[model samples]
Target: MRRRTYLAGGASVLAGIAVSGLVSRPPSNERLLEAAREPSGTGEGSSNTETILSGTDHETSLYELDAPNDGPTAMVFGGVHGDERNGIEAAREISDWHPDAGTLVVVPETNRVAVENDDRRGVDGNLNRQFPADRGPQSELAAGIWDAVESYQPDVVLDLHRSLGIYGLHQEFVGQAIFHSPDAHGERLADRLNEDAVPWYLPFHRFTPGESTLSGPLLFQHAARELGASAYIFETTEFLLDHSTMVEMSRLAAAHVLELHGLLELGGDA
Candidate 1:
């Protein structure tokens, strides 16, 4: 495979301003659409699908997009919690994304049973909590998902979710936040979403970055700890925002993370 440079010019510019406290103007909607439609590398890439947890009721399709050139791999999971419709839609859209020089692995609905039943936890319990720290996955569905993740060995892992309220405002909710591993660019991802995707009127909908807790048995935490991947859990608020906006925010978050990890390269400057 052809090894391509990790960070493109636009991506590097965004990273620079994200750290220096200088804000870059948001890209226009047209530009964002164009970027989304364009292929990342020299030519169109190939794609394939596989079934995880085969022969089981929880089985779901895993979509992979491979670039013509070699770059870091990114894995995105959605619908871990069935009620988070925005994340599931966003992941379905991201499944069609063409990388500039990397591999993109997307599991749009990890817990198929939960998604089908429209419940938070599948029959086996909360799939997110099944991957205990320093231990094997606690459920068969979790094990199957983990097996797929291990086989891919993604360099970056993004799990999409939604909550009923904002993180700071609601005691039990963690929405509009990015929980990330130390090595990941969670702050940058937050900045990007706040600048581009969020509207000026919705000041309360801004995103913030928080360090992922080691005590949690979450899938992202497990990936960060065991695979040494730059893992992130992106949460949006389903209360304030409409369903369309929620999906857009989720899509933007995923795209920005992919760009940060060199799995994508949007055209134009930051």
Candidate 2:
């Protein structure tokens, strides 16, 4: 079927816009704990079940929706930046979401500190850059986040992020998409997402080489180095305050992913 035909209905809604990320002040130790354990887990543990996925007193939530069978495993990340609500919303859609094959390990809010403060930067004002699994975090708090992601070991990672809106465009960048150079795995992942079509700003999304930044595909691509994990960074534009737009954008992204996995039938209700 034609690509657009493939994306007809809700999936095509992904073709709506573009978005982007980081910032912050030193977060209190207790606050970090709260941010870590904020979101609920996959099953009926509580509104805070996703919190347990982070371990003892961990603040950020990791909502994983899957069974421990065989097949491939996927990691769909949302909310690298707290202000980037679209990614968080998208990951939530994926959490209650289930698929036939493989596994889905989701960390809706990778950076809890930012999520709580509604700030983009981490405690140290640095982006939560230690991804693609290096050592653990230098600080006790961030180290906890690093540990969770490293352990999950998702096969394919989709890091959800958003752009800065108009000012971002003036940078000659309406929207940017991350793909690994010479890495077919990353390229293919990007193809899977673009196939669903999104409300990208430019005529087409900008495909950049993953050699810079401590976040997004750069980190995921780096992590792929050791784990052989295929990672791609997805950037959508952001205005925030527009809660409805955020909700719909996340819904479309989730629907697009469901289409990729052939589980649109499951619906978000899963």
Candidate 3:
């Protein structure tokens, strides 16, 4: 089934018809600045690399940090929409945290052009929509971002975003809710997070499958099916939670995912 939903003000829709049978190839001239096969630390090691997307001047910083012991890898993406500063800030803060067991990869600003200009759609259109594709003439920025996601090969993925409307107030918008793919993986995480007092949640909903709408491309949806990993696109209502509170919630959400996979240990442990 396919559904097309709009964002705040009905300006953009998150509906992207799921694309099938598309072959994905890295953009030409895509190069990683790092030389190591794997990051260099045994425990709590971290490394930052710069990715230069061949044709554009846009540059993205990639961060990788491993825990003290072995565990699953979780990937976090922020700033898919340049105007959502909360998710971007949340992502940037998480990159500094040291996990206890697994690997954490973070791209704080996925759409640098949009983020830099505080625009929702970057120069190359919506970055989130142009993914899992076989071609270019597409945004070089989107192509570059896709290359990074595919190369990282995460066990789970999270794309962070912000919504202007409250879910309860605006039935059409995904505000104050977890807009996830159809999967138990995301449901489980959402259930746990919603248990908090004055919880920043409405209900769990699925994105329109197959193709791009106002909402752009569903990144986690493709990642979940193609990569065989649990994935979600988390949205926070801008008015529901204050900036600091939103950041805290984002941190908690990431921690919950890591803890669920045994990659992180919080508080005093059970």
For TM-score, the strongest prediction is: 1
Candidate lDDT scores, in order, read 0.82, 0.50, 0.61
C-alpha lDDT of candidate 2 relative to the true structure: 0.50
What does candidate 1's lDDT look like per residue over 27-85, in tens digits? Answer: 55445544555785388888999999999988899999998779999999999998889
What is the RMSD, in Å, between candidate 1 and the native fold over all Cα?
11.2
* Deviation (Å) of 115 in candidate 1: 0.6
Residues 1-270 of candidate 2: C-alpha lDDT, one tens digit per residue: 353343243233543432221112123322322322333233222221456324533366666554423345667767667788878887776676544445567777766777777878766554446443445344554566556657777666667776653222335333345544233344444443343333334334433334333344244555566566655566655432145444444444444443344322232322
Q: Measured by TM-score, how close is model 1 to the native structure?
A: 0.87
Model 3, position 214, has a per-residue lDDT of 18
Total clashing pairs for each candidate? 1, 32, 12
Per-prediction TM-score: 0.87, 0.61, 0.71
